[model samples]
Target: MHIPARPRQAPIVAGGLPADELAERLRQRLDLPTWPLPLHLLPPGTALVGGAVRDGLLGRLALQPDLDLVVPTGAIHLCRRLATSLGGSCVVLDRTHDIARLVLRGWTIDLARQDGAGLEDDLRRRDYTANAIALPLGGPARLVDPTGGLDDLRTARLVAVSEANLQADPLRLLRGVRLSWELGLELEVTSGEWIRRHAASLVQVAGERVLTELEKLAAVPEGHGGLIWSLEQGLLSGWGADPSASGRLRSFTPEQATACGLAPLERAWALPLARLAALLPAEALARLHSSRQLQLRSDRLRRWWERLEGRPDLEHLPESRRLELQQELEADLPALLLPLLPAAARGYLTRWRRQDDPLFHPMPPLNGDQLQRELGLAPGRQLGDLLHHLTRERAFGRIPEADPAGRAVAIDTARAWLGRRRD
Candidate 1:
């Protein structure tokens, strides 16, 4: 296992921008592994464009530094070199058009060549004027704002380059609102009008892509505001969400989000699914058919829907039945349902309101082996059935918590059920 000695390279130092404070600050903001002069990093004639430039101008702090660069030619291989130079990874996102990405130190540099003849022509085909921005490199680099993106950036307004251009991708209508939410920009009157006009075209786009974009807007608590706007403007109607779902989500303001529940939603793994289930009514949510994308099982959703039915007066239910709901909250509570948890169904919501660590519910103290050991059984379907029965009984509060001795009651109940099964 002889390995070749590694070579050490020079420290990365980025080239200077015009002696402007803002420009230098943006250069430093680049998520580069090291600040080596980028003059010799990529091939000649590469330029920075799109969100990295837009966000830099707006002085927004980038959590995950991403820079979109367009080259004159041979971008895929060039990006591979750039990725290696930074001791990172590269992936060819699109082979036909030669789009590639270099991922380094939480920074993603997407490299592609100018799609059309020149950069200005390329900028013309972009969706929004605020995103149709560029900054040329390796020369007298200056801000190129052909679509008046600099002006839009200055005023904190979003403007589509053209109606036809925006219509090319109806997703842009939603993305406009996302950028608005992201950078705190207001969608321009004309751009908002254009979204309302062509929002229906989103149906023609791919569902998976729509889901992808929705995930971006749902990744953070602030994203709820964008989702609400999209639903209000009919931007999400094309994706099969009920337009009325907007009003429901609009009520989930920062205050309500904090009050009702937040830890589960804010740090959700399937954020889009959490957002959808939190915003939509029980019946409206069933229509999404999103289990595959959300990685949620169909039967679990059915059980959730069933619970909403007979949304009875929990205050008036029999003592045992009220306790059943409380224990049910401890068994497999999905994060999405946290916001809609009524004040009465279970005290689990109360725990969340008080900022508890286990926001949804707590795990049981036992496992299959423990149950089997307690009942004097080996591995088999009958043992599993008994274990599941005991677990369900525990969920219903037939077995008291706060006492390991109480588990024997559940074990006895399971053995009696097995005796009946034998008969």
Candidate 2:
């Protein structure tokens, strides 16, 4: 049996505001007056719950906030009705649990039947105190705080609703770590302990579910720190996170990528790829059932990073080696540059951004068929080798464009090379 910690002092009033004031703030932040889903259309017992209320209270609500509603019953049916009435689509999330989602005009509204006996029971069964709060969406939005979720929010702490609740879904164990870093909150001592205790159980979760959480964590600004903490607590050990890799992940930060001259859109994906590559190898991602493209990206980044580790100066590498690196990582060069010195990384990025840069986007000066017709070369290993040689020369600016004069230059170069091989 697990027992919650008693407050050191008398219980503080929830949210430091009266119910009406809190309700007003939530209503204003969530833009309730302009809601696409008319409140009157909802069931009488429906109450807004989960992240919508949480982010609204924090004043971090997005322009198009996702709404999570708890209903007394018939949530799926209500979702179908909403989809039909609003000219939208309905996706059944869980048929057995009576959970469904309605997507209308860029808004996602999830409706779920209240678990246990009532709304309060459903809130209490949630994983974290900060997420367990609710607000009745019917007449006069009264704040509901059955688990001191507001108080936890006030203190900027993440506390589990209960050990049993976390055990009910072991993914919550990892979710605690992600939420702590993503929301800039500290983990309460007891909740931290509970998460650490059940760290190993996270592997029991579905691979896709685990990958989703990891991707979310990796996308945040403080994701590297969160990953390190997860590693220290042994939460990621089962999924192929090595303690030795922590040093690499620690330096994978948005500021670092920015210093390397990665633009906002580039950093959005590059930083996450760098962080994931730092922490997990390609095989680990494969085990997580990640996409083949993602696995290839990670593998290329990791292999190149390792290759560069032995040769600190990129310019010092042989021309062919440097060309090979550029050829393999043309699209993802920014991700590979995360760990390099800022000056060097900036130089590389400037060239990489130029789509027509021959070295960055390497292409052979002449196709194999063209080479065969021009040089009377048969289709064999020698032909392939000659084509590779031409691409290298083109990438290095030694070969001209494939025009009549340039073809004459290429044929001359090819004949000279063939004569040398014969010698």
Candidate 3:
């Protein structure tokens, strides 16, 4: 494919910022003054590129953003040499592609050999215009945008570098959607069409890579919309994800989670869990090679949700059934609350937060050891049944459990119950 002509001598100010100012800003955010891998260590043709550069332009660079540099050659060797001399660690990410990562202090710097003739050729090979942009290191702060990335950034558009690039790495198809929503950019029309055309090929990519992208996409503030768009475009259909579940994502919003008493950290994991469960069933997650813990959470949430939906209210369920619900969802109650009405969700969350709430956080008033020691009870199925009974009694306030007097009352109640069973 013939590449479009890009400016060789760009304007002093592109993307509404002067090159020098942008460079200074990146240096400040990157903390170049205290960098362990000195600029002198890098070869002449190295350039800082990818997300770091893109995020710097948007003034959203993280405190410790990973730095990506395209070197002229021997990227792996350079990384190893730097690691050995600087007393850091070197991880060979891709030996075939000559990509390696240098870990020093708390910073991660990925060094990859330039793909083609020079920076321009390499930039042209990138997946999206925004990521194709680069800034030369150890030189004047000049923006090398072979794909008109600066203009696309200015217009808040996500344009694919080329259809071929998207085809080269099918993961880029999913990445485009994530980047667009994460950065508040719109996917350009032709680029969106290209993504849809190659969506099926995404299944060929590594499951771990696909899972990583999905996790990041699901963590976005309004990520559900992005997931829905991916489904609508058939990006996730090749996998076991049901497009029909997209509506479930639509209804699960950040506001609903907050109303359910999910703090930032709680929402971070809960929202993604709920959203992922909505789109992919346990079997689908297993096929994706997701963690066993994640699969279990998804399966449990889905099963209980289905069961609870059939009942009028979680509170109105039979005592045994309600106790089971509380015990099963003890850790992930907030996630289950996402689809419920705000008031009801708030009530459940409020009770769940109280560590001493017997029903919400069920605990047996008397263990088998305690029963045997205090009441001289034998250990067997009878003991297990007694423990279960005590847990249910405490959960429903039938057995008091807060103080010394409550403990005495609980033991007496247990003795009486055991005597009744004997009779």
Candidate 4:
């Protein structure tokens, strides 16, 4: 077993704070009761680095910040042990990179083996200086500023460790831009220049990665500004988006989200997807190399919003049609329908808001077996259609959820529906 080094002296606390004071400051910044995690039995050479360190140093940790640790080895076993000890779950995030993840409560801990013999080598390979800083787990809490990350963090500047560091992974290209917006930091002069120089290089990256970054950007309260910045900086263009629509998308300020009246979770998915739909051309979406599933969901969202924009009045439609549309629209993720939720759809929106209401709710006590047995309906396409129709009617309180007389009433309804079908 590797032994942790004894407590050692560190460089003069960058901000002139003494060791104990700095430790306390870092702890408070991260909302932690202690500087480093008090992992008494952990193997040596484990250090906390990346965004956890950055946020703590900047005094900007979220309500619960994730932990990022770099270790000499045993990344998998260590993460598993951590998960077991903490009553969390462990998964290998990337086998090739020897990266494992341990999820505990609301916090995630990512552990990766050191890329080289020393922590400095790992820091040098990191994307930004703000993320390269480290705090050893073994010794007295001493800030590790291998790439001058401490200085950059204090200055609120985003400085890339090196061009090759970013060039090696084009995802870092968008990551740089995303980070600037997330942290409210101004990019360092040269770093900003490098981002622009390599914006188009992102096409070489995968669409899922690009979309993931966009999703993250959209989740932020300032994400609208971030999205505008991404477009203005040619990052979206690199991903084959139509940059001119940034102005159109930028118009969707946080105020408009408030107007949409979607809960926060709903807003996160809908607003971003809506902006992307508005900005990217029909063909542009296909060009991003997104997975088919993502494309399908996106297209469905676009269709719903388009329909809402063209005709939002669902009250006039037949009850069956309205319920059909409701099921199509709500689908558990009402946030995806935010763009389509024009004021005209307020009636349906009001109904949805009353989640406890059995009528017009997404989940209701309606199923196929009851109709088949009660109505003596055979299993076939006709029975299936009847059940779907009855489900909607039942969901809307137009029909009883359960039939006492062996579904005699449902039998009449099915006969009437079939008669209408024939007519």
Candidate 5:
């Protein structure tokens, strides 16, 4: 764990601090690792580089557990060996690209051989000033910043590493916005112009990759504002339209959208069935990627909408009337509909509300079973017809007995009357 001395020069340009002065202050405050540089893996004349030192130079503690180290040679093998020594796993994510990830103690360390044959060349190829700086790993870890990342940090500006840097990966356009929003930093004018110019190119990237970035963006606290900006820049519309033409897709105001969007609304519903129905249209609902709970909610909403729409008489009704009709219809209409329902519907709902009726009231006193038992009628359309007649009669106070015998008598009398009709 022998540490190296801090470098004399800082890499950042902000805070009006000179390189050497910043370096000294960084060394005192940063919690840098004391691991020695593995110079044995370096090529001839290649000096060691540091990531911790750069973090320290920025006047912040290097609390990051894993280190990102760059060497002029043998990065692949070095990563493998480091993983083995540390009792972790080493993976060559892209051999052609010379990129590898080493996992040690639940931390992932990225190792890359300096491209362009040196550390400076490698730093020149990064995407941002903040990420372009490195630190030499030694007793105190020296900062090796080719880009003024610390200066950019202080100014709260996001600057590209170089003009040609973004061409390396078009996805960097999206990354720029995401990072800017996440860090609460304004994008440099040039970088923002480039992003706006190439906004449509985001479509060329894979869907999953694009979604991954979007998910991250959506999770940011001020993500809604950023997303709105992205939309204005045409980043989202280029992704393609939603599969269903439900027209649910629309721009979100900064205040309307937030990181809260990360939680699927269906998952948060206590009465998912009702909440889902209340929130989304049927076609839009079908297109949602949701759990079983949400699906049930969608179904319930659909049914409720159907019941409410079908019963025009219930509209503009009082709460009591709406509730009564809802009970009569055997449908679950939202309580909010009470005020919107018609006067008659409202009166019915009011009457029901005054009584101790359950949200889902029980069926009337008699059903088909009582008919079959008392009248010896077979199960057929007649039973249904008779029940309808009895229901109508009961609604008007024609039938008042709660006993099954009273209901049977009513059913027999209705059947006799209907039997007398020739038509």
Candidate 6:
């Protein structure tokens, strides 16, 4: 029942361009045969904000697609309706937030209701001015800039929507930093002050939410420095991180750290995994407490961190043992290791690159079952002890194969060691 704002004067027709031109252009460019159904069935006043506006404005500025869309009302219902109309699927993400998402022609569009606030109210409530702008759903596609968001976008400045904006949602403090990096915009003084004042409240927000924003910033090709800027502003400390440790970690250039952090083997074979772990601290892994798999990954990373400092006696280890050590080392202290790897370790990694897969190559050949069957051992703690011994042997390249014959010898050695200990 919402009524869209009508242009005050006759649709501005300059250079043969009018208000509906962009919508018409979008309709024409949409090759999907079923687009007409929603175009015809959709009720009026439902605007696609977010990515659609982002891309449209970027297009006006000759930028590429980072498409996102926001539908002001009936967002979830409209997503379902659009999906059915287009023969696609509607994914209801958050019923509470009234958000739904869809993928059309490989472009991601997020749908959300404008609530009852109307455009001006909604813009005022948002985190930043650049994101406060909206483009109309149809016709000349005139932009709705109730908060002068367009001016801030043009100026490449990060300005909060209002003074109360960050206070309303403390997470907005981190979001401001994220948007500044993502859009390559510099934060205005007031916005920076707002973030500094309210940064401590970020801990109250969910860790997953904070981590998501951090991940997005990390994904930016040139946003590392911006992330460093956030850390320098006490944002990480405010979120419960040990500020001194984080500061010390952030002092090195990301490039300098990347050199030591990425194993030569990972550089050649598992570049993506190496790059991913290189930017993060193991501490972030603790934030994902809900995931058992992540916890295990974090534990493995912690063990690796222990190895890098040469805590356990691993000096006399063989190449395979060295490789396993390196894997664990990279996992635990990726952020710390980035700037501290020795030249010898870097060179050794190059010679050990796995051929088939980068992230994980292949499973080890031996296990407890094989050892128990081969060595006539019961399936108990003895079998576990034997497996550990065999793993160490495999790590040192002593176990030639993972077959029954090799497993039998490994178990025999373990039993002898146990017998000697019993004496």
Clash pairs (backbone) in predicted model 3: none
Candidate 5 accuracy as lDDT:
0.55
State the lDDT of candidate 1 residue by residue for 75-177, as single tens digits: 8988888777768888999999899988877767788878889888788889988788777776653566678876666676888999998888877877787
**Model 5, range 1-423, lDDT digits (tens) per residue?**
011122234434366766566655564554334433244543443332343543444433234434566666677787888777768788896687676777766666667777886677787788888777665444343456678777787887889886567866767777788778766668999988888887777777665566556545545545545555676787655554222212111222222222212123311221222322333344433343334544454455455545555454554555555445545444333222321334443444444443434333433446788778866878988777676656555554566556676566676666674576425
Q: Quote each prediction's TM-score.
A: 0.75, 0.91, 0.92, 0.73, 0.53, 0.69
Off by over 4 Å in 1: 1-25, 31-39, 84-87, 220-222, 264-272, 278-306, 309-385, 392-404, 407-411, 416-423
What tens-digit string does per-residue lDDT give for candidate 3 at 1-423? 011111222222244666568666656655666766799989998999999788777665666678899999999999999999999999999999999999999899999999999899999999999999888887776678889988888888999999999999999999999988887889999999999998999999888888888888888878899999998988988788976787678877888898766887788888888888888888888888999988988888888877766443476679988898888889988888888777788888888889999999998886778889998878898888888888898999988776786788789888888999989
Better of 2 and 4 by TM-score: 2
Where does the lowest 10-residue lDDT sum fall in candidate 3?
1-10
CA error at residue 290 for candidate 5, angstroms: 13
- Per-model lDDT: 0.62, 0.83, 0.84, 0.68, 0.55, 0.55
lDDT of 1: 0.62
- TM-score top scorer: 3
Put the candidates in TM-score order, highest first.
Answer: 3, 2, 1, 4, 6, 5
Better of 4 and 6 by lDDT: 4
* C-alpha RMSD by candidate, in order: 8.1, 5.7, 5.4, 7.1, 12.4, 8.1
Name the best candidate (by lDDT).
Answer: 3
Backbone N/Cα/C clashes per model: 8, 0, 0, 0, 32, 13
Per-residue lDDT of candidate 6, residues 187-245 (tens digit): 99988998888777777887777766765665444445656777778777644443344
- Global fold similarity of model 1 (TM-score): 0.75
Give me candidate 5's TM-score against the actual structure: 0.53
Candidate 5 residue spans exceeding 4 A from truth: 1-15, 24-30, 34-66, 139-142, 241-423
Candidate 1 residue 384 Cα shift, in angstroms, is 4.3
